[model samples]
Target: MGVIKVLTGNYSASEGAALCRPDLIAAYPITPQSSVVEYLAGKVHNGVLDSNLVQVESEHSAMSVVEGAAYAGGRVFTATSAQGLALMYEPYFRMATLRLPMVMAIATREMTSPETIWSGQQDAMSVRDAGWIQMFCDDNQEITDMVIQAYKIAEDEGVLIPVNVCYDGFYSSHLTTGVDLPLQEEVDAFLPPVHFNHATLDPDHPISLDPMTPGNLLMKYRRSHLEAMKRVPEVVDRIDKEFGDKFGRYYGGMISEYRIEDAEIVIITVGGMTGAGMDAVDAARENGIKAGLVKLRFTRPFPAARVAKALEGKKAFAVIDRSVCFGWSCGPMYMETKASLADAADQYCHFSAIGGLGGADISTDMIYSTIQKLEDNKETKTELETQWYITE
Candidate 1:
């Protein structure tokens, strides 16, 4: 068993990465995400953790340096948020395309123009299509454990893609809570030393890493990358199970459910606001509402089949998202959830609920109101308009 310590989400993430024993760490500090790498650097500089820590000029350089280190056969880690993530997009896309198995922590925050450094999912959501496996954490422990599991998932022979461990900026990032820090030996056993099938990085056997290719070949690479993504659901499930067996803490694989067995109405959520959603579910149940909650753990793969099964017999559902899908009036997760129920859109009553942008509060009352709205519209068949959780 590991020691239980009260740590903030950023410190938990740093400790998690250190437990895996990264070969190289590179990152440029940015709000919410800044303390994460700072914690790691402190360990390296204090002679407590043995690792090569590089202080880069910017998030772009941070990603580029780690990309090079990854190509040279090293297990690397980095993190950023908001604009930092925007800056890292160029090399970030390349990191996944090059099939580098690494983990980057995202202390998710709102984008600029309105100019805020507060909590929001927009930063991570903006880069969802950039070809990486992304997962969100509900708490500090999850932030720590997911980092360990992320490496296992990424380094799998069949799934050699990068991963993003995303959690809300001030909500989860700066929030302090008790986390059972995993023992080093146990983590070492759970995560094997990084290995690659290709001999490109090997000095004894040098070859082209990623040279210019014909459009036809580039198309092939794209397909191959997609095929690997299709395999991520199973990998995520298996790794979570394995982590559970070792640590005695199990998070239901792709999505976790709370009392959804015979629910007539359900509420779905992503990122840190899931707690509020669950509280709303409990409150609804007390008021004679058959309410249930489904937490969307993995967003990139969508887990459509699993979501379909979860919502199979439900009469209504509401997806609460912290980021907006400007293309539509609703949030991105709402749009995706609706798409998952494409054939049965008319079979159940549902709507998109957006809130928690720019550090806004997504209180239990807000979610329960959505649940109440779902109950009211449960008999209706078509999708309802988007609901924004605004408080005075």
Candidate 2:
């Protein structure tokens, strides 16, 4: 039987780590994500989790420690955000290309520019091509759940890629919430030990990792990474279903569709803004407008086919992005959604609304108003039809 407990974001993470039972927990203290490591530190100290909690001096060292741990056939876990993520860039990319299968949580925060520290998806977006499977969360519940499911997907034989389970820094990571913590027995049943047939530095069989090679071998190594990424959708779906069977909640897969069936227009969003976007969809329904919501839980190894299938016959759609693509005249989510719907029959309408960057509040009212804007724009039949949600 699975144990039950009420948890906050910090406790949720600690419980998640407990569930996975990693061999190493290496992390550096950064705001938001720091609580996760702190809670785990206590667990390590209390002897509840028999793991090495390495207090690395920097995020770079933190990732390096985990990579070394993972290479030694140890299940490794770590957490970070914004600048911390930027700091770990070098090893982070290598972890993906080498298919290390380490699971890390990123409390999403704004990257430096105007110089205010806050929550946003920019940090996650900045590393979209780092070859990791990225999962975004709409709330604390999803944050905890995704972290657990991420490990399963990452370690799957078909998809041996590292995963970043991301949530809004203050919104999900620091906020108080009622999370149902699962029992270790059930989690243990769900996730097996980190067994590697060919791990780095094993005495029985020694091998090389990230070794310098000529162009021919280098191309094959990169192709292997791409193949691993392509296997993510199936792995994610299977893991989510198994997790749902044990945990009683499901995110469908990488992309979750909300009320899109039989709807005329759909709003696409990723991250914490999804909850508000769904509420706005309900409001639009009350007004007899068939507007739906599609929240993308996973960004990298993007579900373009799923996105297209979800919005295949919809009359129009809007993408609500928290991070800008810049120079593309839209956000990353918007561009991806547009590309997905390019071959649709209904002439696939798209509106881009940017909001909630740098910890900015994205209220339900803002989302409701944006759907209203889409309704008006759809009716206007204007020559130019893209609009950005902004404040004067």
Candidate 3:
């Protein structure tokens, strides 16, 4: 149905953005995120893509430029990672609160203090509540696919928040794999042009946009934003169905389950760790252990309902997070999953497992070990000590 090519995750991101026919692409080069804008710049220079390309000095200006474009009723895109994301935090927060419809790609990287330029999701997790729709990718193909889907999800009139399609830096970013790039025509048919305008700043049509407001009015806007976020899961489900019907791929909306029907134990995963998690589940099944897997596809809205439902009958579950949550002594996703099941906390045995920080490999062996731990304590019906996967 589409042309297949071996593309690095960054290129896949660029390819997906190009297919959407954005009006503008603004980004500054940074680590693994560099190639995303580079590829788009090349297409623009070669006249392959008819989009305005802005060469910015920093990630802040990059996001600021895209936000301006979106405010003008233009479908826009940008990409950044780690420190760059931190640099753009100001405008980034405003973009979502403004309810601008656009997509940004985050080549997820570890924040530095120990000083490292490597793959990790600490950057993305740090700003989870920044009001943007954030979803992490498990592989290169999902990275590409979600990029296109992001725009459709963002621009929906009911849910006009921006989206961050995040994938691990160095791991999925530099990792090249075969991707079926949808033809421009196919994408055009699937993703309609930007027809709805949030607020278009024009001299002819004057309209107030994001003026400083009193606390009472601001609270109303916040409530409206929260209500809109509650609609994202259902919007994603309807869109995934439409996407699957048009193309042959169906990624389960917020959470994807594997081998969970009759399993007694489940391994919860997010982002790039899902592949190894599934492998560990298979290995555990072969060893006569009933282990299944549930991949948390979208983390921004948190998908608490889908996650709680997935582990409904399971005896035990362990959430493996690539980024750690401070003060909690566990990963952020693991903390959130536990919060989601607060009412039924006594029903299942669960614990937190943190690993794969700063580009460390999350091997199948390490994941299988976690599954074994769950199997050993499936009958305990209480949370266990947090497990940290490390080579040493």
Candidate 4:
């Protein structure tokens, strides 16, 4: 059994991490995500959690500490947002390539240089290629559940990769909602003790880590990493089913499809804005437009096959992105989705709409308008130029 309680997304993530009973937690404080580590520290101070809480001087040091701890065969956790994540990029990349199984909570925020600390997915999207399994949650409950499932997915024997459970910074991180807190005993039963069969820094059996490799050997390592990544989708689906069976809740694995059955026009979205997109689809349906939505939960593996399947028969589709793709002149998700549907490019119309940067609100009406755009261009068989939703 589990208890229902109102909790902010940050607190929910902290609670979920605590429930997993990690051996160690290393993190530096940053906006939005600072409260997560703060809550965990309180738990450590109050004796609710027995894990060692390392308060490092900087985000870089924090990641370094966790890499060493994980290398020593301990299950570890960490949290950060925005600039903190940027600072930790060095160790962050190493954590994945070394194939260390760990979980991190990222309260996604916009990058600097207009110098703001609101909410955006740019921080996490910026690191999509860093070899970590990235997942986005639409709400606090999903945030809590995903944190627990993330450990299982990351520690799978076939996929020993780091996982980043990301949610919109202020949107999800600060929003309060009721969450079902699962029992510690239940969690323990669901997640077995982590067994590290890979290399470790044990004194008895010494090993060199991340040594310089020749081009051919490096290619082999890269190929091995890709093989492991290919195994992630299966592991993710299995864990989602297993977690649902035990905890009574499940998010559709990888990507979630909503109202797409007979839809002729669809809008794809990610993160907290998904709920609004679903509502927009419903409104569009009421107005006699066969509109639907696809919420992308996992971005690293980029559910290309699933996405293509969901939009297969649709007349037109649009991807709404909160972060831009810089040189691509559109959003990252838009470009990726287009690439995923490359084989079907001549079959239907496609468009990219970008907005919600720096914590801007993505209202239901905006989504409805996007669906209308798709509907208007339903018969066209060409990709449109990127549309900026909230032109300043």
The lDDT values for all models are 0.93, 0.82, 0.92, 0.92
What shift in Å separates residue 69 of candidate 2 from its native position after superposition?
0.7
TM-score of candidate 1 relative to the true fold: 0.98
The residue-by-residue lDDT of candidate 2 on 1-392, one tens digit each, is 34455666656766776679899999998876788889888888988888888988999999999999888888999999889999999999988887888889888888888885788888989899999999888776777778788888988888889999888878777778677777777778888888877647666776776667899998998998898888889888998899998889888897999898988888888888888888999999999989988889888899988988888777677888878887787788888877776655247556778888888877898888878876766654232344555567
Candidate 1 yields a Cα-based lDDT of 0.93
Decide which is better by TM-score, 2 or 3: 3
Between candidates 1 and 4, which one is better according to lDDT? 1
TM-score of each: 0.98, 0.95, 0.98, 0.98
Off by over 4 Å in 4: 204-206
Clashes of each: 0, 1, 0, 0
Scanning candidate 4 in windows of ten residues, the lowest lDDT window is 383-392
Among all windows of 10 consecutive residues in model 3, the one with the lowest summed lDDT is 195-204
| TM-score of structure candidate 3 | 0.98
lDDT, model 4, position 365 = 91
Model 2, runs deviating above 4 Å = 1-4, 203-208, 343-346, 379-389
Off by over 4 Å in 3: 203-208
Model 2 residue 336 distance off true place after TM-score fit, in angstroms:
1.2
